[model samples]
Target: MTIAEDRAVELQEQIRLPRSMRLRLTRNGLTLVPITQAHWTTQRRIASQIEERLPGWTAVGEFSVIPPREGYSPEPDVSAVPSDQVLPDASKFQEDLLRFVVEVVSPESEERDYSTKSDHYALRGIEAYLVVNVLTARWTLLTRPQGGTYRHAVTGDFGEKIEIPVEDQTLVLDSSQFMRV
Candidate 1:
């Protein structure tokens, strides 16, 4: 089998969402379900915060990363792309143009978000990745991707403010508003 096909089979095995659930593909090889209410709350809060903090940037929740094929799912819980970065079509956003991706880990999603998704984002050269674990009330930020991995990672409590180094300036992320799962 081709490498992509192998990865697709692997992802289908790892994902636990129901067969009836709708799925989206990430440039990474994974399948994802729609966000739960708790996940949505956190995503919405973070998106709003980003929009407020960075005026010209747009934050998207559950925005699937467009892949070359039909079956990869690495959709971030929340994503921020520059407002001016227009795609030829609006149906989906390109993974390369994504400035930031945030994932909220749930029991079923812990492994993929922390491992497979991280590897995929890094491989695609995504600038920033944030993982919020509402169940644990902790957050982790990964940045500076190199060789299909992040070179820097910072972990902290939910209430702590984080400095996301985007471009030259830092975009402050206020995790204080995040609701616990």
Candidate 2:
């Protein structure tokens, strides 16, 4: 294999997901930005912070998140994959294995993150979904997935502590540090 291809293979093995931030490997090199240029750093910071705080969980950015059922789209901003779950490969991960998803709303990605992805995650039984709008520095947490949608939706500004209930426990997110208004 060529050097670049060999490096991709090596990176694929070393990257353990959720902890890698917004980085993705392509044939060219590592990609740290794919969604919005303005908010990529902020997005990466938020995902990395979550991974650091919740060391036991897998917090990955820009991964394809799909339902266990067939024919589900797998494009999400950030996904919190439970570390205890096992997957066959990196190409795809079952929705049931994902405990939460975080999508930062940029001007270019507001509609998709707010409406489309929310519907998909809820339909697939994802326990929690967080929508962060860095420009406004606001956060919305969606939980209690039922009837093909999240029954509970809570919104708060930056610096506020948001409690995200997932599985049988609660994950508290403190956005005071990174989410600047």
Task: Identify the leading candidate in terms of TM-score.
Answer: 1
User: Distance (Å) between predicted and true CA of 147, model 1?
Assistant: 0.6
Native-to-model Cα distance after best TM-score fit, residue 120 in candidate 2, in Å? 0.8
Q: Give candidate 2's whole-model lDDT.
A: 0.68
Alpha-carbon TM-score of each model against the true structure: 0.78, 0.70
Q: How far does residue 11 in candidate 1 sit from its true spot (Å)?
A: 16
lDDT of 1 at 176: 87
RMSD vs true structure, all candidates = 5.0, 7.7
Tens digits of per-residue lDDT, candidate 1, 126-154, equal 88889999888899899999998999999
Per-residue alpha-carbon lDDT of model 2 for 26-142, expressed as tens digits?
A: 334554433454366666776676677665676665555543233334456666667666354675676777878787776645676788678888888888888888778888999
lDDT scores in order: 0.76, 0.68
lDDT of 1 at 104: 87
Candidate 1, superposed: residue stretches over 4 Å from native = 1-34, 69-73, 86-89
With a 3 Å backbone cut-off (N, CA, C), the pairs that clash in candidate 2 are 18-59, 18-60, 64-74, 65-74
- Candidate 1 residue pairs that clash: 25-72, 25-73, 26-72, 26-73, 26-74
Question: TM-score of model 2 relative to the true fold?
Answer: 0.70
